[model samples]
Target chain A: MLKINSVGLTISAVPLLNNITIDCPRGSVTALMGPNGAGKTSLLKVISGEHKASQGEVEINRQSREDWKPAEIAQFMAVLPQSSTLEFSFTSEEVVALGRTPHATGTVRDAEIITAALAKVDASYLAQRSFVQLSGGEKQRVQLARVLAQIWDHCECEGDASTDGILLLDEPSAAFDLAHQLMLIEIVQQISARGVTVVMVMHDLNLAAKCADQMVFMNCGHCTAVGTVSELLTPELIKKVFSVDAEVITHPVQGTPMVVV
Target chain B: MKVLNTRLITPRLCGLLLLIALPMVSLLGLMTGPVFISLADILSITLSGNGGNSQEKLIIEIIRLPRVILSLLVGSLLATCGALLQGLFRNPLADPALIGVSAGASVGASLVIVFGSMLTANGLLLGLSAISVGAFAGAIITSVIIFRLATSPQGTSVATMLLAGIAISALAGAATNTLSYLADNDMLRRISLWQMGNLQGASWDRVGLCAVTAGFLGLLIPREARALNAILLGESEARHLGVNVEWLKRRLIIYSALGVAISVAVAGVIAFVGLMVPHVIRLLVGPDHRALLPLSALAGAILLVAADALARVVIPPAELPVGVVTALLGAPFFLWLLVVQRRRT
Candidate 1:
């Protein structure tokens, strides 16, 4: 479980994230949704230990975020940021192999895990291709493979064993095609079902509604609402936060709440 | 889709081939002076301690050997710094000379020479004549300052680093010029020769010192190969991958700066070898630092030894400042690269 309590982050007197308290239970998917510059990414950075809070703190599995060394925090939490800027021509296999950096493990097993991750994302074909040559959607999938490979052992889920880890993704589906987007959702669900937490910052409300177990909506660095999809998917709330007319309707196909704007 | 894993094989092969080629190239450098010394003569003289013609043996062992060895060490150190800096900055144009480290080190060495001369005229100075300490301090201070100036909340901006590097390079140049201005004609000539960068300052003791420094830094920098690879993914991503970004940056900055400083102290600001050698190597082997760093070292050594050999034979009697030959060789290649890059864009 990941918990944030009164975390406020300031960069030279400008509050990027303010007094944000939230909770992510184990084996669940929590999607952060908000308008642009709403601090969703900042909040995610704080939780991922990339940004330090000027006030308050984050606790993972009841462990203080500050107390945990970088390697320890990285052992469980994997973050995939928006819009990769990979400048080198490293092969997709090499990029995915970087996931095992934190684990003091042998390459033979790590290579197997990388292959599995690429296969899971349907990126097995791109494994030998250079990362710079991959298309946008392909790069996203490869990065997803990297994040997946970070916690591959947890996802292996031995008999009666509850696997543990957390995945933090920022706009993972931003440039993905329809098939890859669905593949991403399916893979994420598979990961959560294995008992790892998935905290994703997503822009697609309908997709988030269908996929996430809980929702946290932010506006101007403040958490305006935090609850299940049904509780947070009100038209008035979306209108007030997003400044757009939105209609909330139940999906007849999946029997879940959907937001149309 | 089924490509063989060449990244693993390429480095090993490049290293092995270079290891084989290095001694031959060094032997060529040993052979290429005004007085002809064949490989056979070199081997005989080296093994028996007295076989070759007496004058040729003196030239080989007493004069040329230390100079050639010093060239190899300085070249390797400079090129390694260049590769490390490029990796650290993530910019192909990032060279220690352009980024003020060499100029900064030159300033420190110059200050010592000028002020130490004053103190020694009255016999006030002792045990501090060597340029290494001064050069190392200067390089460290300049890198720290430039790094601080360029990094902020927006993260380390490449544009800012480049601009700051230019500004710091200018400042260090001015400081070095001021030191030269205060010196007499004799000291000024010494300063100019040092500034021109040469292997004439070579001695067995200096060669030993440089070899140890190179080996030490060479071992440690390549160990960060994996971390450096992750860093290319971006700072935040690298941090997420458990690479201590701040720590890595600090460590590389200090190590590369020292690497450049030591070389500059010995070779006296040889330019373009650091800048151009890595570019050439990257074109051949690509930019994986695991390969790039070690390969750049060997390439740097080979390039300088060859250039130094050319310097010896260029005029037949007087030696050319090796730095000049490198500039003449590198400038056109650099321009061609820029042209190609622009055309591609």
Candidate 2:
């Protein structure tokens, strides 16, 4: 379980995140939804230990984030940035193998995990290609595979009920095509089903409705609403949050809320 | 499996080729000098200490051997430092010289050259001459300033450091030129020659200093190869991957400064070996530092030894400075690499 206790962030005397609190339980997918400059990424950074919260603290698996060593936390917590600045000509497999740095699971086991992770994102064919040569969508998939490989073995123990890992992503679907986005949603579902806690910043409302178990809506650094898709996808709430007039209706096939603007 | 094997084979093969080429090039350096020594004679002298004639033995032991060893050590240090800096900055064009360390060292050496007569004693700290100590101090100070300028609570900015480095290099260059202007005729000649970077003054003492620096780098750097590789993915990304990015940056800057300082102090400023060797090695083997670091070191050793030998033989009676030779060879090759990379992009 990951808990954010009234977290706040102020950078250079300017407030970026207000007293935001949320709970992300095991086997759950939580989507952070907000407009531009809404503190979604800031909140994600605080949870990942990239930025420290000025007012409150974050707890992962019942331990304060400060108490855990970086190497220890990295074994179970994997983060994917929105984009990468990796300019070197490392092959895709080599880039993915970097995710295995925190574990002592020898080269053979790491290779197996890398291959499995790549296949999960449908990027196995690009394993031998250079990362710099890949298209933006392909690179995003490879990066996803890398983060997956970081926590690949965490979800193997089946009997335990506690959370095995936490995956943090910032705009993971921003560079993906329609098909890859769907594939990513499936991968997130599969990983969460294996008892991994996932927190992601997403833009597409209908897509978030399709995959997310809970949604947290934010505006101007404040989290305004937290509920399930059926409860929070009202047209009035959409107008107040996104400032656009949208009609929320039930999906014909999935019976979930669909927002049409 | 096929792809993996192919990726794995290239580095191994390149490593083996470099290993083979190192000894051959060292032998070539040993054989070609003012007095040409034949291969058999050189081999016999090296293997059996007392085998050759006394003059040949003296020439080999006193003059050529130390020079060869110094070139190897200095070359390896330069290239390895280049690889480390490039990895740290995440810029392919980043070189040790690009960061003002070399220019700073030049200013330090120039200071000693112009003002040495005033110091009553030529103080030796850790077996290094006063000039070397000055150069090392200058390099360290410059790097510290550049690092401080680029780093804040937000983290180090690679672009800021690059710009700061250029500014510092210009400042150091101006200092060096002013010293040159004030230098007398004899002092002026010494400063100019040192600036050109020659191995003609190679001694057992200089060789020992370089050997120690190279050994220190060899032991410390390879351990950080994985961290260096992680850094190429960006600082925050590496931090997420469990690397302490701040610590890694500090350690890399210190190592590069030390390596470049010592090289400049001992052999003046030899350019392009640092920039060219690592790049070529990266091209041959992929950018995996586990392969790039050691291969770059070997290739650097080979390039310098060969270049030093050519510097000796290129001019019949008078020898050209090894720095001139390296710059002449490296500048065009670097331009070619730029063109090729541009075309590809």
Candidate 3:
């Protein structure tokens, strides 16, 4: 499990996260939703150990985040930002192979894993294309392949039941087309089925409602609500937090709460 | 089934071809000069270490050998530095000299040329090579300033790095000009020749120093190839891939500066070897640092040796400064690269 205990973060004397606390269990896909400037990316940065919480602590698998070696943590967890600002022209497959940096290099198994990860995202055709030449959505899917390859072999809980590899994505579907977005949902579902914890920052509420096992609603750097889709995706909460009027009704197909704005 | 169509093959072939080409160029460099030593004489002297006339032997061992070795050594260092900074800044336009290290280093060298003889007479900067020390310090100071300016919360912004380079270059250029104005006739001549860059000053000791430093850098730089590959993906993304981004940045900066510092100290700031060699090599092979770093080093060696050889023959009796040749060649190529980038973007 990933545990955040009253975590507070400040960047340049401006607080971005205030006393944030949450628990993310294994084999779950949690969708983090917030408006712009809602500290979603900052919180993901903190969880990935890219940023530190000034007031409280974060733990992974019951051990403090600080206690884990970077490599040790990396072997089981991966993070993908909305976009990678890579300057060089690495082939898409080469970009995917970098996910294996935390693992090993020059092994046939790594090649298999890389190809398989790209196949999972339907990005196998892009493998030979230059990453720099790819379209924005194509690049995002390539990066998705990278993170998937990072934690692909992490199927077993090392010592704790909650120790399955966790994947944190900041606005993973922000640039994705409808097909890729739906493909991302299926990919996340399959990854979760293999006992991985998935925490994704998502901008589209409908995708969150339809695809996520849980929803986390945030506003002004504070997580306002967190629960199952039915419990949290209420019209009142959406109107209050998102400043939008939406009618919450059961999805005719999946029986989950659907928000119609 | 094997994944034989890996990215590894082309670079491997390129490296092999480069390795095969390097010796031929070096031998060509060894053979050419005013003396017109026969190929057999060059080979026999090179292999046996003692043959031909004593004067020819002296020419081979003391005069020509150090220049050839120095060119290769300095070339590798500068090219590797360029390759590194390109990766660090995540921009193809980010040359090692973009931070004004070369200009600042030249200023340090100019100061040494103007006042160094007096210092030696007074024995003040004792047990030290004044020019190298000054150049190294100047290069390092400029690099550190640019590094500090470029790094921020949003990560190392390209604008800050480029702006700092321009500001520092202008400042250092003015300073060096002032020093040149103040220099005596003899000091002015030294400053002028040194500023243009000369390989005629090559010595065994300087060759040894560069050899060791360049070897260390050549071996050590490839180790960071994996981290550099990720760093090319940006700092945060590299970190997400488990690279220690801060540590990687520090190592790359220090080593690149060290490489440039030594090259400048030895070679009076040869322009564009760092910028041109890596870019040309990158275009040919690809931008994978594992390939870029080592191939850049080899290609750099080839370019400098070839340039030095041409420097000897182009104006036979009196050698044109190697820096002028590199700049004359590099400036146009660099402009062409910019044009190509502009079109692509």
The numbered model that scores best in TM-score is 2
Report, for all candidates in order, the number of backbone clashes: 0, 0, 0
The candidate 2 chain B region of ten consecutive residues with least summed lDDT is B1-10
Interface RMSD of 1: 2.4
The docking quality of candidate 3, as DockQ, is 0.52
Best by lDDT: 2
Report the Cα lDDT for candidate 1.
Answer: 0.83
Error of 3 at B307 (Å): 0.2
Task: Show what share of the native A-B interface contacts model 1 retains.
Answer: 0.49
Candidate 2 lands at a TM-score of 0.95
DockQ per candidate, 2 decimals: 0.52, 0.58, 0.52
lDDT of 3 at A6: 93
Using DockQ, give the best candidate's number: 2
TM-score (C-alpha, index-matched) for candidate 1: 0.90
lDDT of 2 by residue, B1-345 (tens): 234322324889999999999999999999898899888888899998876688888889998999999999999999999999999889877899877898888888889878876651755665566777777777878888888999998777778999999999999999999999999998898788877888886889889889988999999999999989988998888888888888888889889989998888888888889888888777667799999999999988888898899999988789999989988877787678667655644
List the candidate numbers ranked by lDDT, top first. 2, 1, 3
On DockQ, the stronger of 2 and 3 is 2
